[model samples]
Target: MISIPFSGSKRNRYKEVKQIIQDNGYKKVYEAFGGSAVLSVNLFREGLVERAVINDYDRLFDLYPAYLDIKDTLIQKCLEAGFIKSNKRLNATQRAYLQSMIATIDEKYWRLLANNFVFSGKQTGSLKPLYFTYFHNDITTDKQREYLQTVQQMERVSMDYKAFLKQYFKDFDDTTMIILDPPYMNSTQKAYDNRYFFGLSATLQMLQMVKEMQVDFIFFNMIERDVIEVLKVFGFQDFEVSTRRITQTSTSSREDCLAYVRNHF
Candidate 1:
């Protein structure tokens, strides 16, 4: 079993979010975007969140993480993906054949489609990118081993936020803190890397619902044209805190864009 270090993600903002929740005397926390679940895992680890609800639309968000109670399936999915990848770098015909063979398959075969899509070069098809790419990293045996170990660990102690909420949040209101890390509208232009496609208007509608929840809230978003306009509509007059976008791949044209918030002001 290879060791997988706990590399932080955009959810690293959980540290600050945790402090805000605690300082505000919140008892229940909600992590709505739950990709990688870095926010849920870290806050739960720190014991800052008493009860939480972590939800995401992505299947991989649930399929891969231990928090979703999917531990034993990791190794199986990896194996089903088949370790003997097309090392020769499949030609167009071979790639097409593989895609044809794997498309519209079952959840058990998510690994196969994922492996061929990525290692064989993802072909265009009706199945959403997120559907096939869930197993994209399954191409390497060593990487699979590492993934299995991590999923095992995440399963062993991962927070089941949904279960926690159903049993606890029925009557909770103001004491609840909702933390949103939804995909930023500014990130809409990116398509090459693994990014879940979400309708911008739909996301805005959800944010509107979040505002109506009357629960204390915080949000993480990339500062961009669409976002500023959305925030304005939501009655956010001042930004609580802001940080510059980092990393070399974070949109060259939007390097000036940042991660900002509305609740801080």
Candidate 2:
């Protein structure tokens, strides 16, 4: 039930993905591209996984210690600074205060709080001027406190997915499942920041490496021809899941494919 305001988060597809993992009887989950780490934490919480490793290239991992140690303090500071209270959009004065806090506060706290304010839970990974949004639903302090509790048991690491997989994939056993949710290979849109934009070549290289390693994995990505072909070449079983993309102007339905390789190694 922990909600992280991260762009491209898998929270919506968690139940489906969790069922896949559970059916495979995977007791440990390694979230190779752990954006928001929705699967890792929730799987651990629900007792599907005895161990979870959350790894991401983004600096968001740097804020985990802050959340673990001083979440109450962070919430209190936000409350005192008028950052949280209602489901209303920020006013001009409140915006000014938030801008100042982003300018002056330490990167860890500010970046963590920045997630709650950005439009559509999209992060830019910069201290640049932020596009503000309404505070409501899961973006409240009470919800944050509840969410923070779920992450305490997870092991967090900040590293490029290639390096992370190279280092740890060798240690995985039959009970381990590596969840690969890399950035979309067909989209140029920057989800979190420039660092998150994984080009087609890089995506192919990652897929090739995963194939060579012969480890069990569940991969999530948009239904692109090249990606589907590559997964097919690797002998993965494909399942397409329908999803919606919500923009400021409209919402459109799209299909996202989940490809998995079971104990075929």
Candidate 3:
């Protein structure tokens, strides 16, 4: 299995989600908010789905293809920079080298490296002074190869989730399962880049749109009163699941709920 050092990644929930899809006999999956694209990759790897699509609003959407284009170079650069071989905290000089690399390298490589090195896998454009954390050595050569192989099998795109849904709705069928893991209504947005924040109105609008489409879907979110009420209005029932909540300051396990319309099954 390929692990993505990304905040809000569904690594922990992949097994349960895969089981749900398998039990429902879904042959296709559309990851509406593909943070790391890990779920889709895992499903494809495990042969649970015949087709997978990964879409995201951020430029991180482009990183997968970029990685594929320069997998060797990126791996070599990380190894040369002492990022892939060690799991220790970076010293001042080592940190300076990383910052310099981020400042001077191509935007794609820098963004990929920045995410890997940042604290708790929170997305950042550049490391904040005094906020740089220990280097994550999880993306080794073998892992990179695994990621490349799985991602190559997926259809990836960068677009607004609303636009993505509207365009793909006609293509959905009984065998298709839509995975909606939108940004939480109650999160500080620190886990995400500032520009990708999904506010309440947008969340409600998305829910209303999905309701109208009447597609088979699984929606993940933090438990919030207004969001839950809106989901109830749309006929979505709550399924309580434990998920680790990652924040800028700390990480804790919490009960997160996913809403699904019972009639869809």
Task: List the global CA lDDT of all models.
Answer: 0.48, 0.67, 0.67
Model 2: per-residue Cα lDDT at residue 111? 52
Per-residue lDDT of 137 in model 3 = 47
Q: How close is candidate 2 to the true structure, as a TM-score?
A: 0.77
For residues 1-265, write the lDDT of model 3, one tens digit per residue: 6665553446777777877887888898888887777788888888889999888667564565555445446446656866644556677877776565555556546455544566654445554534444566454446655676677667888788888888898888888888888878766662334555577767788888887776777778776455467777767764433444434344554445565443353
Residue 176 alpha-carbon offset, candidate 3, angstroms: 2.0
User: Which 10 residues in a row give candidate 3 its minimum summed lDDT?
Assistant: 239-248
Off by over 4 Å in 1: 1-8, 59-62, 65-170, 189-197, 224-226, 248-265
Q: Candidate 2 regions off by >4 Å?
A: 7-9, 65-89, 107-111, 121-123, 126-139, 190-193, 224-226, 235-254, 263-265
Q: What is the C-alpha RMSD of each candidate to the true structure, in Å?
A: 7.8, 3.8, 3.8
What's the TM-score of each model vs. the native? 0.54, 0.77, 0.78
Candidate 1, lDDT over the whole model:
0.48
Top TM-score hit: 3
Error of 2 at 168 (Å): 2.0
